[model samples]
Target: MTAVTDQDHTDHTNHTEHADHAGGQGHADAAGDDTGRAEERSENAASEEGTPQDGRSTAAGPDGEDVAEGPEPAAEAALEKSEGEEPEHRAAGGSKKSAAASAGKHAATGPEAPAKDRHARVQADSEGSWDDGLIARRVTEETAAQHVPTAPARPSPPQATAPLAYDGPLRSRLDALRELVGLSRTRLDSRTLAEAGRVLDEAASRRRLSGQHTVVAIAGATGSGKSQLFNTLAGVTISETGVRRPTTAAPIACSWSDGAAGLIDRLGIPGRLRRRPVQSAEAEAQLRGLVLVDLPDHDSAAVQHREQVDRVLALVDAVIWVVDPEKYADAVLHERYLRPMAGHAEVMFVVLNQIDRLPGEATEQVLDDLRRLLDEDGIALGEYGEPGATVLALSALTGDGVGELRESLGQFLAERGAPARRIAADVDAAGWRLRSVYATGQRTGLSEEDRDEFAARLAEAIGATAAGEAAERAWLRNANRACGTPWLRLWRWYQDRLDAPTGRFPARAQVDEEATARQRVEQAVRTLAERASTGLPAPWGQAVREAAVRGAQGLPEALDELAARAGLPPGRPPRPGWWPAAVFAQASMTILQVVGGLWLLGQIIGFMSPNLGVPVLLMVAGIIGGPLVEWSCRMAARGPARRYGQEAERRLREASAGCGRARVLDPVAAELLRYREVREQYGRLMGVPAAR
Candidate 1:
């Protein structure tokens, strides 16, 4: 009996310990499930709120401190109830295994289990001191919340459209340049404008052709190993090398890929002269868009060979100038090609071929020297990340530095911007060359003061002031003729008839002859032209002069006609209101004198009684009164005559000025306006503001 009781007690104790362990394990599993569900719920809520799940919330309290949130009220309530029932759940040893099994099943099945079993397991798990049931409920609620409808996304705002006139920077510039050339055709010199036109044409043709291909011309002087380098770059012996003075007579093209036929054709390369590289993946991939051309020697003795080289160089996208140490600084190459084309440094390459012949360290020295010479030639050196002409040394015969050249070419090809860059550089070069024709030291135009001076000079040439003086004298003479004593007027007429042969009285003011007038007109026009042409470019100044000369051609004849029409009328000068009274008084005085003289004569002849006092007094009075009235009339006519003369002078001056303005000033102004328009267009083309 004692052994049995002891064994039973030991077994019961073991059973209790096993139950406790199982319950503890169940609690741990439940807690883990609750923590996972809580984390899941938190993630869902954070995502819904568009907040980061990095252990912090974007939400802040009113006081600007971060706010920490707890679980939901329903979850807290369920957790409290589970804690309240924990002791009873621990006391119920019989149900402990079932509860642990159920908890395990719920944790494994998650929310995918049947709703009834999940809820029953949650309640049983809640009977322990764990919040697993609350967390599971929260997850379910959050999952359901995901289906709630959200507001539709906001629509994006509309974007502004670009203007049609602004077709990218390069295209717009090209178009503007074309317009500028057209406008400048009449105002500028043909040589510079012609060059600008050629640039426009080339840019248009290049853009229309294959943009994928880059046409690079290998140009050098005679016996400069141009063909050898060309063949090496092409990886095939396409161009024939020879020891002759001029090895390549014609341009030979080698393309690295297909579809370069259009580009090659535009370059004027014949089908027979076109070649392709040997099929290699690496070469094709690196240089697929390259169109290499071996041009004839630029300094060839043969005229046709040099001509061919020049033509091809003008049409190519880029140039590789192959020079040996002997002729790297050749005067002809530097002056003719490099110096003139300094603006094209971005698309230019100066290669020092035949460096193998140089001794140790001479390569670097030659390269440095070549670079210095290029600088003197005005070509920018593209070294160490600067934008300029690329200078490199390589030898085709010894295959030295050829790979580096190839690699550089490959990198250049990869950019696929060679054609555009080349055209842009050409435009820049052409603009620089034509700068002298367009640019000026100061703004030029016709000024009001200049116009007035020109008109004044023209008026003076027509003798307008002299005409007015003559009109004044004519008025005075006519006033005397109208108001003088009749007897004196008769004597003057008789004397005028007698003196007419001597030409004493002038009819009108003398004017210059047609030839003299024309000279004066031209001089005036030239003066105005020179004034307007100040600080203008040569071409524009010449144009202004031509316009002034052209307008002045008909000016002299027009001014003469105007002078004739502007003169006073051929009849008598206008009679004043007091002229009639003066004439009547003079006539009465003459009659008195005649009567007095008759009385005196009769008395003396004894036809009547002698009245000596009355007759003598009457004769003296008549004589004095007639002279006095004539004097008074002459004095009054002076003021009116002067005014009349001034009016005539003003009319002539005004007429002459009008004629000059119409013929000369208007045309010159029109020419100036044209120049301004073209200048504005040039400014746009060059990407600068127009000068005033």
Candidate 2:
């Protein structure tokens, strides 16, 4: 009879008294007809069957939240019906040993479960060759399953959408990680990337160039049954199996077929722990190029054990986290490993081992809860972890879901994705950690407006106004010396000498006067540096600040030298081209005055009759011409002097501004450039798409 139908397995529960006097045949008939119910009397025979192989108490756990649902538990009741045509109508006969041996024999060659995931079974002979079924005792207890009424397929676990293959997520995540790592090589903390890169290179090189096997790590907390699962998959006793805490101190490598020496050698496993599996055609053929390692407990009390786990974790192609139903919700497992490596969900597998210990209903319930926690940890499942992370439920000691795991490893190896995907996850993790320093949005440099303000302040510090005024006055004085009336020119020159020394610089006092403005120049540089440093990482900003202030000690002396050199053009502008004309006009006027004066003297001596008229006319002409020449020269010199002075002032300011730019603004600009460079590096490190 089909007692282990998917429908019957759905509502597994612990109860009493399923073994009745109705005999095994009658029980099978009733199971086919009535779905099981969890009355108080279902587990009568199960109680006497012996200890459950799950190695834990078979009691219901506290009701809790939704969990990460793993693969359905393999059903055990597919073939428990009586063999002969006649109904052997009798209660379980003889000692409990015979009943257990009989149950193992039936399951070893049992019919298939309703689901297609069921593996072909190896039959047991009369002498008790029953190693193929779950723990012998558990199978013995399940023999009376037909007598117990079960709920019809409790609830088909929410049918998962078709499995999402790892193509998109795996490739995309890897590319993203590579780009981020390349950018971060120069900036951010290299220690993390260096460690990650070393592992990446080692893994990718070994897997690709060597064309070797996939290195899969079986990891878990102590007592999670990883060793047993590892040995079961290998079909041999390669790893130690025991109840002792922290049983495996070193990782053990098990290779399916012989060409994996290179891959295992790179993993650095000791020769003693590494063993080649005995090849079996029906078993693990697909895992020919696979290297499966059973690692020490991740939460081991020995620091070395934890360290070994971490080292191997960083190097492996993929990691299978084997957790028991009891400690599936462990914080150390989820936080330290799962949550941080969520970017690598593509290459991670979560196994809920020892599902046989939980009754069918509790199995599904706990699986769902585990899934919920994985969701919180950012691990997705399904074909590609799209809907949820891939979770498997199996019992290593019972040999119950081990075959499916072996097959999955075969499929994973054939895809040739674990190494790239694992590295991609690493890069993703490193990028996330540096987000604080690398997330600066855009790259920019100091603005022209800011530079101009700084330049103006530096010009002030160099005393441009003092130099420019002196230039203008000097130009005016030279013009006056050339064009002024001869007698007054000497007097004016002498008078001007005491009144502020036109055209000559160096009051020496002007240098002292610039002290306050020098401080202003320094302040301007600081302000510009501060503005440029905004939004940068602390190191970059500090570097910019230091660069801006580097030449502070020599700045004052440099400014003073620049100020002294910012003098008027030598000897002022040459005398106006028209000055000679003014001199000739004045000379002619003097000659006329002399001639008129002589004529007047002749008239007074009575040397010529009526000469007084000519003398008087000449005298008047000379008098008018002299003053007119003087006025004309004065008017002409006014514009030329003013223009020359303005030209000199302009030149002085240009020279002063240049000095300021070189000593002050230039340093500020250098700092800004440094800031822009670092900012660009930050963008690259963060993997921001727009950093150019």
TM-score of each: 0.64, 0.64
Where does the lowest 10-residue lDDT sum fall in candidate 1?
Answer: 1-10
Tens digits of lDDT, candidate 1, 243-278 = 867778788787765456667777777655665444
Q: After superposition on all CA atoms, what RMSD does each candidate show versus the true structure?
A: 24.7, 17.7
Best by lDDT: 1
For residues 1-692, could you state the per-residue lDDT of candidate 2 as single tens digits? 11221111222223211322123435334333111221111232234444232111233211121111111111123122322321232112112333333332233222222111110011011112111111101111343332222211111122222211335544454444455556446444677567546644653454343344577899999999998788667654456667788899898777654445556666677554565443335444578567788999999999999999998888787889999988999999999998887777777779989888998598888888988998898787765536334688888878677778877777788877676666556655655665555455544457788777766666666656555565556666665566555556768878878786545654556544667866866887788778767776565566657766875557766766755665554444667667787777777886787899889988889886765788988978887787777777767776776776566556655765676577655766675554455445434434454342
Instruction: Give stretches of model 2 more than 4 Å off.
Output: 1-211, 257-259, 282-284, 382-389, 496-500, 506-511, 551-553, 563-567, 574-688
Query: Distance from true position, residue 65, model 2, in Å?
Result: 56
Model 1 segments more than 4 A misplaced: 1-194, 222-225, 235-237, 240-249, 278-285, 300-302, 354-360, 395-403, 435-450, 501-558, 581-628, 662-692
